[model samples]
Target: MQTELSKRLGVEYAVFGFTPFPAVAAAISRAGGLGVLGAVRYTAPDDLARDLDWIEAHADGRPYGLDVVMPAKKVEGATEADVEAMIPEGHRRFVTETLARYGVPELAPGEAAGWRITGWMEQVARSQLDVALDHPIRLLANALGSPPADVIARAHERGVLVAALAGSARHARKHQEAGIDIVVAQGYEAGGHTGDIASMVLTPEVVEAVDPLPVLAAGGIGSGPQVAAAFSLGAQGVWLGSVWLTTTEADLHSPALTRKLLAAGSGDTVRSRALTGKPARQLRTEWTEAWDDADGPGTLPMPLQGLLVAEAVSRIQKYEVDPLLGTPVGQIVGRMNSERSVQAVFDDLTRGFERAVDRVNRIAGRSAR
Candidate 1:
């Protein structure tokens, strides 16, 4: 299960698990796989620093990475205030009416405020990168695009490797041009902001385009056979996200977990811009359908769309709004039928990789030679 990438990262397994849960990230790193914590949940620098402190204390000296989304193209000069101001009256009314129709309750006083759609914007992510560089992180990953030239230089100055997620070969090449150390070729079946290319078609193309630099395959990969398929496609490693959503360590809310377990299938998810401005894969829900409706207010772009629905999302989760409660998940959600610990998931990945290797050996048929 080891590759050059794993050796470079000082991990025993080349499996990279990208998750938002700090606990899940630490667990996977402790279990020999690279666990990359998604930093989108941490809008404030102090919050991110505190979480990294915890990860450092518990990761058993295993290296882990930080993932942040700073897109290459976004509305410039769009502050939180600007974004709020940009939300149309119709869109706001749509959110209000939808929540009312669903009977979703309002957040109680002192309840955690809904996530502000401010962090994914460049300014906040830059601050996040600064905080991440201050820690002893082994890798820094930009989810939406290549890291800025200065950001890459700064990470390199600290001996931290820079990785970026690419939806196509062209994007991979652009990352290379931007001096990215690693490229994660995430396919259409992946969770959250993805492009049209499927992993099977995208992986080998990215591999060839970014030769001499390692490419990690993502998208509809959940089983051992999928891992083997990724490697056969010339990927140096497999990056899994959705497989961990149902894990015990995952921070998914009860209603979301229930929906994931009882309803989600390979075909149950859809890619829509209803959640965030960009098209991202998520379980089908009334939230998405409402935005897709002909009579519904059309979705806004980027930070504005997220701003427009932030309160609605909070109310939906707080009240367990059944028809609209969903999270970003890939098509692999179908295989996530049961809750397991992070250690169990790691063990399964290892066992699956072994079985895949053995099957390949059997197919080679040494006796025939």
Candidate 2:
């Protein structure tokens, strides 16, 4: 069904699936939903080129988009090299020691090289934007904040629709000022980096604040009823992230993490700043618990903290020793019990939406009678 969002993006459905995996992106697009691939960690232009090319080939000509992080603030006068230098030696040592305590070992030879961390710098993000612009991406989404004026101007030049995520009405206004096409009113219940407000509260506030600018409801939206609620609240579509992580096509192959996600309930996740410097919702694990410990060394600032823990996080994943090594996720993980194909998930959602709408109409009819 074509909603205002579909019309705006020239897509077939208003269901927007976001992921870091290229295959997932292609699959969602092919399944009649818009697929958005997160390119935050893409450093080398060629890497992005290859990923986009792969998505284009596999997408069956269905439209897709790309996401990048453009934080509204940064350390003063910090160049890429300078940011890299700011990563403390003590933080690195702590990461290494923590991993060792958990029985995760150092990366082996070529493995370490392949897992090298990149793209946490401003220049690197800009470089990624340059590469993305050269392609035929239909939509460009900024995660952390509104994009730079130059980025917006350049995307407009190429006819790419720009979207940004906002946690509050204030942020929605800022996105409007930045000339963004869509505002994802992500609530505190959303996975990854999120704000303090719940979806039901944030969605209407953002919609009212940024009148005429389409809003997408995100955060804790995992079912058809949730989607209907979003539309009823005046959202043009829904932005989903955590719901897709447990999909069969997800890149998370680790048995431990998968088990945790499947077994988790809505209350299992927590908002912690252990991964990125910002408060992000993720599964509460031993690693995160350690960070919350009163006696432990506190976390550093954004990119510096990310860089400090990258190598150790890699080791944890390589060893398959723990489920807490990854980044943020939302409380919706509890509902993610099984790994269904992307198309199957979309079908279920569509069916659920229909049922929910029918129920609502019946209730309204009864009230009128």
Best candidate (score: TM-score): 1
Reference-based lDDT, residue 123, model 1: 86
**Candidate 1 local Cα displacement, residue 87, angstroms:** 1.4
Model 1 agreement with the true structure over 1-369: per-residue lDDT tens digits: 889999999998888999988999999899998899999877789999999989999999999999998978877565778768877898888888888888888888787666676777888999998899989999898998898899999999999999999999998999999999999999999998899999999999999999999999999988788898899999989999988888888777665556555467889889999998789998888889998888878788887898788777877876777788888899998888888888998888777877887888788884322
Cand. 1 TM to true fold: 0.96
The parts of candidate 2 lying over 4 Å away from their true place are 76-81, 109-117, 366-369
Q: How accurate is candidate 1 locally (lDDT)?
A: 0.87
In candidate 1, how many Å is residue 364 off?
A: 3.2
The local lDDT score (0 to 100) that residue 91 gets in candidate 1 is 81
| Superposed Cα deviation of residue 14, candidate 1 (Å) | 0.4
| Model 1 lowest lDDT segment of ten | 254-263
Q: Which candidate is the best by lDDT?
A: 1
lDDT of 1 at 193: 86
lDDT of 2 by residue, 195-243 (tens): 8999989999999999998998999788888899999998999888888
